[model samples]
Target: MRDEWNAPWGSIPELVRWAAVRYADTEAVVDCGGRVRVTYAGLGARVERAAAACLAQGVRPGDRVGIWAPNSLDWITAALGAVSAGAVLVPLNTRFKGAEAADVLRRSGARLLFVTGTFLGTSYVASLRRAAGEGDAAGPLPGLPALRAAVVLSEDAPRSFLTWKDFLASGEGVAAEVVRSVRVPGTAASDIVFTSGTTGRPKGALITHAQSLRAYDTWAELAGLRRGDRYLIVNPFFHTFGYKAGVLACLTRGATMIPQPVFGAETALANVAAERVTVLPGPPTLFESLLDHPARRDHDLSSLRLVVTGAAVVPLSLVERLRADLGVETVLTAYGLSEASGFVTMCRRGDPPEVVAATSGRAIPGVEVRVVSPDGTGLPPGSPGEVLVRGFNVMRGYYEDPAATAEVLAPDGWLRTGDVGVLDAAGNLRITDRLKDMYIVGGFNAYPAEIERLLAAHPDVAEVAVVGVPDPRLGETGKAYVVRRPGSSLTADDLIAWSRREMANFKVPRWVEFVPDLPRNATGKVVKGDLREASGP
Candidate 1:
């Protein structure tokens, strides 16, 4: 058999096929939520069945199939199955409320949706029904005319939805050979990951199958992932890093996947000890929580060996603590965004402690990284400027949004990352600031404009400006300065409580200050730099 790195599979389907035969008996995924374990062979069969089911639902190639749920065994099967059947995967954020998810679904024109029953006390199906209201025509959710079916990944479902068992059984009629006949090419768009940029509206970045395979294959090799190494993936699958680095990387390396739907420090410790989880990738807050948890000494976490963290600032102290306290063999930091296929500069395995803690390492092979000034001139080493990347892994473009795509992608093929950074003498990339007012909240990207737009929906909120404030535990959290409407007796606590219901938990501001008016410039644009300074720690 060809080595995963030397002769990588072209498409996800080809990779799945190869791994199923090569690692048939190897433990593939361990879903703690349902206490299920499947081998690579089992996963492959399940994916084929899932593909057949999609075909049974009349899903055609290039059709958009969206999965709006948390991490689980069923999620993998369905997502991979949809892709194997020639559909472009669209993973919605599990943290999204009903309205937030519907907006993306409408924009993408998704045909089939696989939604969870109820997650974290809220019934997703009910929330979706409320958000969609009554449709003027047919389909599971009338508000989404393009959506042909909605499958609930649970035993029971609402009136018009299909249960997990029923959905799988529908495809039993199709022969396996028929499913194998449809081979997806490497150039076909694999997934469209939607990210909120400066516009505050989420745009889908179209990434091809080749880009996904090549990037994560490199990610697996760089991280030293190998056969039998169990990985505990806490990152949400909706994001590119979570799906590409967590799932796809494991497949290439024959590693076992342990999906954590939600992150709780205690639960994670238990899983690490119980499952002998060797690889753990998440935001720095996750490590901080594990390190500080009072019950740390109670668990047998000796099996924990590798950790990969980034997105926000990485402190030297945190790096030392992981190696010293937990006896973790390797702890590395890296940086990437959805636009770059979530694979960029990452510290090598044997790098010194100082380098790993300080900078996101040199660019990956076949990719070029350059820092440039506002005048489009290349900046010298140590000068912080806009980071530009020209890479095979860079996304094709935003799906069908040519004007928006043209803004960031230059004609010369250099992708303007909009992130301010400096390249040291050794080419290590250290991100200093953002051209766009975006922040990282426990690994989730939080854009100020997106938060402002959501906050504006409040009836009493006259105006609001959000800035990222440092949190010791969470890398950074949002703090909002608001101007309440006249005669509105809106309290900070009141707005905070209301925000919990309206937006994702990470996007919700941790602190709210009432202001007379927002600080604005001559052009009337909100001067967020001033707000960020005023909200300083």
Candidate 2:
């Protein structure tokens, strides 16, 4: 029998081609800055040009190509093009510093990098150059020996980088036939997304084209996404939520994608009024800001039809406010991770505010979810335990790290999702907490281990342990329990300032406590429980 859950498109390139042919004149994407717009046909052509450019740059099948840029029209074209040309796309978080991004490129062995020249008043190319150092005029840069080229996406490229226009221009020498013939199998790795590991680094999760298409097809349906819907995507593109759920979902349904590089209440409200955006999805903090904005009622927001929020607890009042105040018809909450292709469960449209706010809803079709005990047995209903997932949506494996992959992905295809949740009798999942020590700062994952590593680099920080503490605005923010070195008079403010420059904004600690020593247990591990209690209200 034929599979009912199989996606109509076999691969990412195939999906774009199908959309171009089916909706040639339909607007596919619009830059929120009013800089560029493209129809389905136009997007298809640009993607092919990008693919041809990759071919010209010698990107081979199975090779990794990295994009270290924020949400932009070129980000979409470059990422799709790289994957279309049979190279695995590695999306580096735009919030990362040069050192952080270089770590991913080095680990992924990416040979080419597409970076933004300037964004949010910082020159990323310059930061990268500094990170690479001026080498001894010969030996490889610190950790990026595999990266051979840097293409800057900007009006004026830096002296050391290739301009976006020039990068595309290089494709002129490569024939269209050659680009079209470079096809990756549906099951082949399309992207290697890096998520924070407890080991003070990040692990690459290998995802396939078919997995992405199938998973988001279900996501779009449950979220009430449809043809001609104007989707204002505020989520960062490096995440699976934006790249797969936001961008690919739009492509699958013929929705017009409007990428918002920055999330601000006034800015998002302005775009909604101007673009008549029907679909808006973000973290609860986004909606809270929009609702609490001083000019909340100033804009004509009647065009909004659907609102989806997650990555933290969804306030019932927020859902009610969107419907009562903003006149939004549907507001939903979802639960997923990068390992699950960014899709697992979603609160269906029209679900009651209580259910929508309280639970993560049931698993999508073709995916099985269970709450298992520590010994690997299924837990009874209403009992919270580790959530385990088994389905096509699960990632192939942690890229090139079988040992790490084995810890999570079982031999029988079940994935050990390090999240604690209870499955009600109705199959709805109410997320209680996390099995892993990860905190959500405005929908961004701030792994304690990752933050601790960066803090340990501080000159005055002799010892440090990071933990998540409650925050009214960001759901949870990091609090660093630090022990200063002898004779070192480093203040909490000093470490906070240092963190701002050393790591991503979300991962930076919001609070710091200077203690003489860390409380430890018999096992010699720092007692995080004591730290959390000490960081009390």
What are the per-model C-alpha RMSD values against the true structure?
1.9, 1.8
Local error of candidate 1 at residue 103 (angstroms): 0.6
- Global CA lDDT computed for model 1: 0.91
**What lDDT tens digits, residue by residue, belong to model 2 across residues 1-537?**
113676657989888889888879999999957668899999999999999998898889989999998888889999999988999999999899988988898899998889988888888877887787643323234447787667889878755467899999988888878988877788999899999777767999999988988888888888878999999989999998888889899998999999998888899999999899999999999999999999978899999999988889887888889999999999888899899998888887768899999998888888889999999899999998999999989999998899999999999999998999999888989888777788899989989988998899988999999999999888899999999988999998899999999998999999999988999999999888799888843
**TM-score (C-alpha, index-matched) for candidate 2:** 0.97
Provide TM-scores for the models.
0.97, 0.97
Q: Which candidate number would show the highest lDDT if scored against the true structure?
A: 1
Expressed as tens digits, the lDDT of each residue in 307-400 for candidate 1 is 9999888889999999999999999999888889988899998999999999999898778999999999999999999999998888899988
Q: What's the true lDDT of residue 187 in model 2?
A: 90
The lDDT per prediction is 0.91, 0.88
